[model samples]
Target: MKNLARTARWLLTLAWQADRARLLKAIVLLTLGYLATPGIALALGAFTDNLLDGRLGATFVIGVLIALVLVAELMMGHFAHLYYYEVGELAESRINSELIRYVNGTPGVEHLDNAKFADTVTLVREEIQKARAYIEALLQVVLLGGQLILTTVILASLEPWLLLLPLGALPPVIMGRYAQRSIDRSRDAAVEQNRLARHLLHVATSSSSAKEARILGAEAALKRRHERSWREATAKLWRGQLAGAALRALGQVTFAAAVCATVYLVLLQAVRGLVTVGDVVLVITLAVQVNAQVAAALSVLSTLHAAGHTLRRLDSLKTWPTREPRTPAAVRPVPARLRHGIRLEAVSFSYPGSDRPVLREVDLDLPAGRTVALVGENGAGKSTLVKLLCGLYEPTAGRILVDGVDLREMPPEEWRSAISTLFQDFARLEFTLRENVGVGDLARMGNDDVLTDVLGRAGAEPIVRRVPGGLDGALGHGYTDGAELSGGQWQTLGLARSALRDQPLMLVLDEPAAALDAAAEHATFEQYAGSAGEVGSNGGVTLFVSHRFSTVRMADRIVVLEGGRVAEIGDHAELLASRGLYADLFELQARSYS
Candidate 1:
């Protein structure tokens, strides 16, 4: 109960914060709604009395009152809907923006990859819609409660003895609570099942899994799994509907009993000469109006119950931890080149949930204007080491120092601005060719001169020039007029993107030229030599990770790893003379291509 109270309070606070103006308007409309209910009941009661007496003047007045009540009701309903829409849209936008921002900024990358997190994201998306409905429904509940109370007061004043009959219908509201709980339970189950269904659909449609699924003839099996999830979700929904139907029937029975009790009280008053035929007509009219009010209030409760899961999900999003906004650091002019070497001392790291470490006790000294190579077999932690150095990941043990300042202590956003990195599996962003490369440094993204120069340095100028829009040409298979680049061409684009960085202090490439042919690789390395190292004597350090021995041979120094430990570190000739791991691997690669 306490937990529920806390959750309800949180949801109310979120709604309250959404739109103050709309909330205030909605409250005023609800109060008007309450006042209108009594007028409507009184008008009906007066019409019944005048009809019994056959009074034409009273009938004319009743007719005018009815028209006024109808007009006011229509206007209130219109403004209430308008107010709800304005408030609902505001709440939905606020919640969704916060959800997306928090998901993007959350610390652990693992959380972003999990099944539960994916389901939560999907539920949050659905919750935005539900949240909109919830606010409107909640406001309706308030209006319904107010109207119900007003109608009851009007009926009680007309005949005190008749009020208990309608009060006896209170047990039906208890039934409405049971209905709500049942619906809420099913809704939560449906959300979970829908998540599973989506995951199954992804597995069946994924490009990488398609070929295997066909070879194994597993399409039918996957379809069956999807259907099973759907069935489970639907079954829960059907059960809830059955329970709601049963409870609604019970409410109808209670309503019938209230009508019988009201008639008996009216007869008793008539027998004692306490009420005239005209007064009896008025009493019956009020009783019927009260019944309808009770029914409307109960129905609102039912609707709220059905939407409880959505409210809970929306509340969860509103409660998600927000990233604290800190004042920006005082901007100091950074030098064009690194003043000192970048050092990694006894650094070790492993990805979340993995028992085996990717890099252990790895130490490196990369001085400014030098070219360094990381050589190892696949999974030798080459890529992980680059990510750590580039400030994407912090080392589990030890520290990275830049000009003797610990990298961990620096703002990660500020640290990242000083380096450019292209991973082995860099994203093929679906955007214009210029936008794709220009995104490396968003501040300089629209500078056409810089974009052209960077593309020229990466040997991608010819590719861009051939496109219809040149720099503006869209790239990807996802849209009309989208041009697909070959693997080697994409690598060049990645290189161009790195080149766009504003005075990058270090350039880190993980298997950068893996797709280029031997001759293309040679030419690419030659171009890299002039553009990568010091133009005169002071430039950013360039670090390369590759499986290709030919590519590693171009580096000034190659560091070889064997089982997460450095096996050898020396220049190409020195390692070859020593006949160590680097020498053996290079000879084997050379023999394969001979």
Candidate 2:
């Protein structure tokens, strides 16, 4: 009974925010149909008694009335079910779609990286279906509750002594509901644990870590850890289900005993000459009807118990603030070149949860058509700076300006649309050859000539030539007959994908290729240098990051970053002559190659 109360409270609260008119109309229709159930049952029972008394005329009249009531009940019930279903679907879809939009439009990428936010993502995916089911179940409970009250009231009037029947059965119901409370909490916790366990298992089994796991013989250890989590979750789930079932059985037994006692009481009343045999018949019929109604109500209660837990999970989404649609701002077009240069002045930034800043008091300027390469060892704040330039991250305490306009005030999306980027770990979309390159320019995606042209420019023509189906060839690791490209080949295709974008003003290639041979790497650099300064009717200022000195040498200038600041900025020979950090790193790489 406690669980029922809790579920009822949740249902009322959830519906309170919905369209009240629709909810009220649905309830009224359901109540009318429910109210007619006992009258139909009583009239039929009276008709039986009347027939036994040779009152054919009264029996016939009651039979016709019962027929009319049945038709009305059926019509009302059908339309009520439709309204409830539609309302539940609308609530679920609207709530979930809004949550999705908010997540997608959130300002920073770090929102997805937070553990608690990740947990919410998992919960939302799992609970959307459950929440919809809960709403439907809630309506069922409402309908059944109305039926129970109406039937119980009629049964009490028919035989006043039978009032104790339902009341006597209440204790076991209360116990069952208490058991449900524990079960619901445990079930929710188990689901969360299972999600984390599954994520761990996926990471452990990935091909990227497979070789290391095999050499270290960590497979057995990983399997054992997975098994431990599985066992813990399953144990909790089974315990909850078993306890709930036991309590439910106890309730059923109590209800059965009441039915037996009520029958005996009616028979005794008939024998005492206080009631007719027909009256006793009516009491017995009404008792059976009441039991059926109560059973149905209990069934609805059980469903709500399970659904209530799921609804609570979804209610968390309602608390999340809604996202307003982004109104497109008036954005100035990119200049033919970075004439006045791009500038980051007094820039300061830190990662989502870190106390220490990744970039501090940093300043940079890249003039028109100049290739600026950033050189840094791993974790020297290279990628963070790239994200800042790409508009993926905003400075915590500074300004980025393009032609003296603060980038923060300018439309970030417009700036992003004007740049092409190839990250160190670029995605390999599982699609056809055309789509692989065409995604760069969505407007020209299916243009065969444009795709071919970009493939040639990015040096991915060799891959296209080798595939059996040419531009139509399937590519991915997932397909059975899928042709997987070598690391160098994949890098070339990624570059081609970037090149397919129609005339972006700035290009970013972060560690574009670290897998190619020395000669191929040199050739790639030559292609990059040649692409700058309005080359081949296409134009862009290229900003690249590379660990290889051979690749860095092709840039018009190099900026050496140390301790979150630019330590040196000059052309290759100029920096080499200075014998600073760049010269030292260049010597180290050159000697290693020798």
Candidate 3:
């Protein structure tokens, strides 16, 4: 009962916030409509009794009153619907906006790794889509309560024994609560499978994967998997629906039996001459209204229960702690320039929901203003290390120090603002070319001179010349006149975006040139290496990861990682002379090109 009250308050608050004037108007209309039910019955009974006695004047007045009540009973609810419908739509939009802000404004990305969080988000999204139905159910429940009260009073006035008719509604209310619980459980259990089915459907129909599916001849296989998942989800829901229907039928049967007994008692009273004909008519009509009210109550309660469940999930999501909350007073400011390099001491990390550490305890330093290259096999934690440097995740053990200060002491947003990065898997935003590249530094996005300079530095001038509107042209295939560039061209644009951050304290490029040709890759690396002095002047560090030995040799120092541990660190000439793991790998790669 407490939970019900809380949910009712929450729903009312949402409606009030959406549109106060409309909500008031709707309430007024709905009240008049629902209360008119009992009024109509009373007027009809009075009119019947008057006509039977042949009182022409009283009969005419009573007949007119009955007609007026009937019109209000039929017309008011429909008019109320127009106002509430708009209220529901506006409430839904507000909730959706809140959801978007919560998901995007979180400080860390760790919560995104949990599958349960994803499922809850999916459910909340689905529930908010039914906002219209929820609002309607809420209003009906309110009006119906008043109607039921008026009905009980009329029944009791005719005969005190008829008051027992309203009690019959209890069984159905109980059954409805139990039925809703079963349905909720079924939906929870089927959420994962339903999500999988949706993913499969998207894959089957998406244009991006069309060519690959045709080439691999996997269309039939995808179809079969989608059908299987959809069937499983559908079967679970159907079972729940069947169980709920059966329970509701049983409850309604009990109520129906009670209604017949009440009517019979009223008829017996009339035969006994204990009550007038008008009393008999009023009792019979009120009994029928009680039965209808109980059924409507069950439906309204079901919708409210479902909406309450959704609200609880949303509340949980809002309170989830994604990262340790820090106060501004506790956070240190980022240094304007790096006087010393970054140091990693005994640092290690493991991803969420995993026991195995991706990066084992290791020590390293990147001196201010020098270029450093990282080389390793696929699972050597190169990308993880880069993410750490960018403050995406905190280390599970030990700490990272920047210029003699603990990295954790500085604000994450401030620290990240001082860094620039270009990863192999980068976003291809389907917007204007300028917008795509300008997102790197929003403050300077509209400065054409800055954009042109960055594009030239990244060797993307040829792409700019090819596109119809240069920086202003739309990009990607989403637009009618959009230009879709080759993979290498897109990578060049990503580089240009990264370059927009001028003199960042840390510049990280993780396989940034993988899509470019051998000559282009070499030229790009040479240009960056030549500009190392300018980057180093402000004590900035330029760290890059590459597979090509030719580009790796250009860095001032190289670090070799193996099995999640640092194996070697030296300049190219020194490593070749030491003839360690680095030399063997370089020699092997050189032979491949020979």
Candidate 4:
């Protein structure tokens, strides 16, 4: 009951915040409409009695009163609906904005690694889509409560025995709450499977995945998997629905039996000359209204129960811990330029809910004003190291010191603002060419000269000339006149975006040229290496990851990672002379080109 009251308060506050005047007007109008049900019953009974007694004038007046009450009952609710509909729409928009802010505004991406958090967020999103229905259900619950109260009083005035009719409503209300819980549980259990099924459907239909599916002849397998997942999800929901239906049926039967007994008792009273024909008519009318009210209440309760669960889930999400607990420390600003550069003092990391560490305790340093390359096999923790340097995740153990200060002491946003990165799987933002590249430095996005310069630096100038409107042209299939690019072209744009940030303190390029051919990749690296002086001018360190030995050879220093630990660190020639793991890999790669 306390939880119910809290949810009710939250819903009412949401409606009030949406539009207080409309909410009040809707309440007044709906109240009058619902209360007219009892008024109509009384007026009809009085009209019947007056006509039977041969009082023509009184009967005519009573008949007119009945018509007015009936008209009000029919029209007021319809008018009230107009006001609340707009209110629901406004409230829904507000909640959606809030949900987006809550998820995206967090500093850490740890929650993205939690499967339970993902499932809950998915359910919350689905629930908020029905925000308008939730508003309607709340209003109905309020109006129905008042109607039921007045109905109980009128039925009791007819006879003490009829009081039991309202009491019979209790079973259905309780049963409905349990039934809704069953349905909610089913939905919770099926969320993962449903998500998988939807993903499979997307893969089967999407243009990007369709080509690969055809090439691999995996279309039939994907179809079978999608069908199986969807079937399993629906089967769980079906079982819950069946159980809920049975429970509701049982409750309705109980109420129906009560209604019949109440009507029969009223008829017996009439036969004993204890009541007039008008009293019998009023009793019968009120009994039917009571039954309808109970049914409506049950439906409203189910809606409220489901909405309450959604609210709870949203609240939990809002409070989910996204960052580790840190002791009180003075916040520090990010440095304008690297002096001693970044030092990883025995740093280690593991993803959330995992026991195996992705990066074991290892010490390393990136000197200021130098270009360093990271060479590793798959699962060698190069990407994880880049994420740590970018302040996307905290180390599970040890500290990363920038100059002499701990990285954790600096504001995450400020620290990240001093860094620029381009990853292997970069976002393909469906916007104009200028907007796509300019988003990397939003403050300078409107500067055409700056956009052109970064595109030149990234060797993407040809792409701009090829498009329809140069920088202003749309760049994806999402638009009517958009120009689509190949994979390599998109990667070039991503590189341009990364280059837009001028002289970042740390420049990270994690497999930035993965989509390009060997010759193109080498050429791109040569261009970037030629421009590395600009980054070096600000004491910035250039860190890049690549499997290509020719590109790796350009770096002043190369660090080879094996099994999440640094295996070699030296210049290209020094490592080659050492004849270690780096030399072996370089020789093997060199032979591949021979």
Residue-wise lDDT of candidate 1 within 22-50, one digit each (tens)?
87887687668657766765676678778
Question: Per-residue lDDT of 414-481 in model 4, one digit per residue for the tens?
Answer: 88788889987799988999899999999989999999998997889889998899999989887666
Off by over 4 Å in 4: 50-75, 325-328, 466-470, 479-481, 530-536
Query: What CA root-mean-square deviation does each model show from the true structure?
Result: 5.1, 6.1, 3.1, 2.4
Model 2 off-target regions past 4 Å?
1-99, 160-193, 204-212, 231-337, 465-469, 477-488, 515-518, 535-539
Those runs of model 3 whose alpha carbons end farther than 4 Å from true positions after fitting are 47-75, 275-281, 327-329, 459-474, 477-490, 526-537, 584-594
**What is the alpha-carbon lDDT of model 3 when measured against the actual structure?**
0.87
Write the residue-wise lDDT of candidate 3 on 410-438 in tens digits.
Answer: 98889989999998687777788899899
Candidate 1 pairs with clashing backbones: none
Q: Distance (Å) between predicted and true CA of 470, model 4? A: 4.2
Model 3: pairs clashing at backbone N, Cα or C within 3 Å = none
Instruction: Work out the TM-score per prediction.
Output: 0.77, 0.74, 0.89, 0.93
Question: Where is the poorest 10-residue window by lDDT in model 2?
Answer: 317-326
Instruction: State candidate 4's TM-score.
Output: 0.93
> What is the Å distance of residue 448 in model 4 from its true position?
2.1
Return the TM-score for candidate 1, rounded to 2 decimals. 0.77
Name the TM-score of candidate 3.
0.89
Clashing pairs in model 4? none
lDDT of 2 at 394: 78
